[model samples]
Target: MAAGTATTAPTPEPAGRRLLRGKSWLATVPLLLFFLIGFGLPAVAIVTGAFTVSSDAETGAGSFTTANVTDSVQGAYWTALLSSIKLSALTALIGTAVGVPIAQAVLTSRFRMLREAVLTASGVLANFGGLPLAFAFVATLGNAGELTKLFHLTDHGWSLYSFTGLTVAYLYFLVPLMVLTITPALEGLRVQWREAAQNNRATGLQYWRHVALPILFPSLLGGFVLLFGSAFAAYATAAAMVGATVPLISRQIADALSGNVLVGQGNLALALSLDMIIVAVLVMAVYLPLQRRSARWLS
Candidate 1:
């Protein structure tokens, strides 16, 4: 059409490059299979079972029903779920408050040994929970525990099996978890930002309030979401420590599965599990967006 006009043609991809790209997907085959077998199948089963009821108890034949889900949200089950949410929220908040300062301290420390030591301890402790953690607290704070007897804490109406005590137990690991989570975000803060604030006649508190906190807010909230999920799903520690005394969703699920309180309530267990899955999905929905924002700033 035009004598002087130059048109660019797209380069064709080589056959070998196309073949290599096809082969690259093969590497993910194992992981895909593992996920399907491990998570996907179980998730499908839970959802399906939550909506089914037995047509014949002996033969285990089932029919679709919404009764399981409806039952899961009433009476004791509802109370247990609320208790779990409250406990998780409380521990997550306290853990975040405690952890941020400790993380900042570890990040600002001049001594490498101290930093390494704290980090190593945090790594170990954050992964420490369940029966052993329960026993540890019971031994240290129970009615007849050493410190309890020594300080006569029981006389002051302190009980290790109560909500307050469970909170203390949760904070043990949750705080360390927060420290591990928020440390990298703390490290992402540049010295230049602090210097700029100083050059502007900003005090340390002013710098943190305006510059650092704004930047770290996403990470902090993400860390809170993590702690909330951890505490929410925790079963073993609460089961071992408080038993039926403190009604928890996890405990209720366990009881439903084991038929401890009723016979043939397996579908109810699945329903409870579905509730947990919904909560976890909501938590991820919040966490993922915050993580993306934090990565943009920190990375």
Candidate 2:
């Protein structure tokens, strides 16, 4: 332990490993840049605008304020938020219930073409929302439309503009979205597990109750969160379908941003967007742990 004793130099990591790390980062550059430009900028704009006030009379720089955020949390906007939540939750539930069985059927199908067709259709339908979707439903179910007129359902007090009808219209896309989300989870139910259960003399019900459901539960819950967020943030579909009749948060955001055109209403819209971003963050917070748990079974 003499002061003059020579100390050993630490060994460096292997060249290949360091190069691998560098390459990994290099590979991610495009995606990282896209994330920075696409999502990051809008997020920054939303947060800053949510807190922004008018340009300073002296310096011409935006002043900071929380007034817009405060208003976003108050009466009408709050009500719209509640409406969005209720509608999103209900539709997500319905979509999951309906989509799960369809996914299961497709997953277990013997015919590959049938499965492929259904899956292809599902992919298309999941993305088939917004104004065009609204118009499609209107043309099909409106009072003067083919089925409605032929069946005379309008005389029986059926209205496509009601909350129930809006929920139904939402299902047009949502069910497919759920199917897309859950299909892979259903497929991830390994046949080995089923055969193993059978070897143990387990019934179909017993196997699902004890094993299958446990594995699938986390995935299912994650899908529900995704579905909820998607519906919560939906704008164009609700706007085109019911306009302001449904009082959704997205509708209010649009109104604040474009329709109202009041001074600083853009800030209010940005605050509403921040609220949505918060909800999405909360959803991911819950989903992350559940997804990690799911990986234990899936991996």
Candidate 3:
């Protein structure tokens, strides 16, 4: 350095900015702890337990083995898993198809109260499932139900305990969930885009096909993935309604845990849980990118 030249010190960060940064990080501590305790630890335990077999039931000691995971993908377990996947996919597809139009209608409606009512109802209904929902359906559609007797539906071969009935029950909640999910995306559609299409001599159908649908596709697909995960993980409703008759993976997991048919099968339950986690991870893998894409357009 030249002797005549003077050096300057770097400017320090403002105390308020430093405090804000510290507070922001402090706010995340509870959330981080929640994920660590509620998800991370349980996930680790499930993975470890899935790969080990109990050598002594009394002591809960186990040795490492891959048989639990191998068995989870075979026979009854595999069948149950497939059934779950099919059910979830079917419900999600139907829910999306039915929901998108309803959401659009709700969005375009002139009445503020109507929109508020539907959205509020949807928020409640989307979270409404499990035993109460099952019971309500059973009372309304069961063999001895009033509707069944009045319309002779049972004689016409409609059974609430069947797979078809389960699909119907799933839709009751899924459709509302889809509505709640896709309404914002529908609302995000700028009027200028439609006007621009109209200025180019495009019909409504052509405009939707060329522009609107493409823009909304990510939100639509993300909603489908969300509904699929919801249906896939649902257990209480299926358990209450159809019990073991449906052979769903959730039911299978419960059976394994309880040793309903097999003794000392807790490890098998962990394997099934791991399977569920993998499916959830895959669903999230697909959902997150779609969500990011949707946010780019919508936001």
Output the number of the lDDT-best candidate: 1
lDDT of each prediction vs. the true structure?
Answer: 0.94, 0.87, 0.93
Worst ten in a row by lDDT for model 1: 286-295
TM-score of decoy 3: 0.92
Task: Give each model a TM-score.
Answer: 0.92, 0.89, 0.92
Candidate 2 clashing pairs, residues 3+ apart or interchain:
none
lDDT of 1 by residue, 114-174 (tens): 9999999999999999999999999999988999999999999999999999999999999
Task: Pull out the clashing pairs in model 1.
Answer: none
Poorly placed runs, candidate 1 (over 4 Å): 1-18
The residue-level lDDT of candidate 1 at 74 comes to 97
Model 2 / residue 123 / CA error / Å:
1.2
Off by over 4 Å in 2: 1-23, 55-60, 259-261
Question: What is the alpha-carbon lDDT for the whole of candidate 3?
Answer: 0.93
Error of 1 at 15 (Å): 5.9
TM-score (C-alpha, index-matched) for candidate 2: 0.89
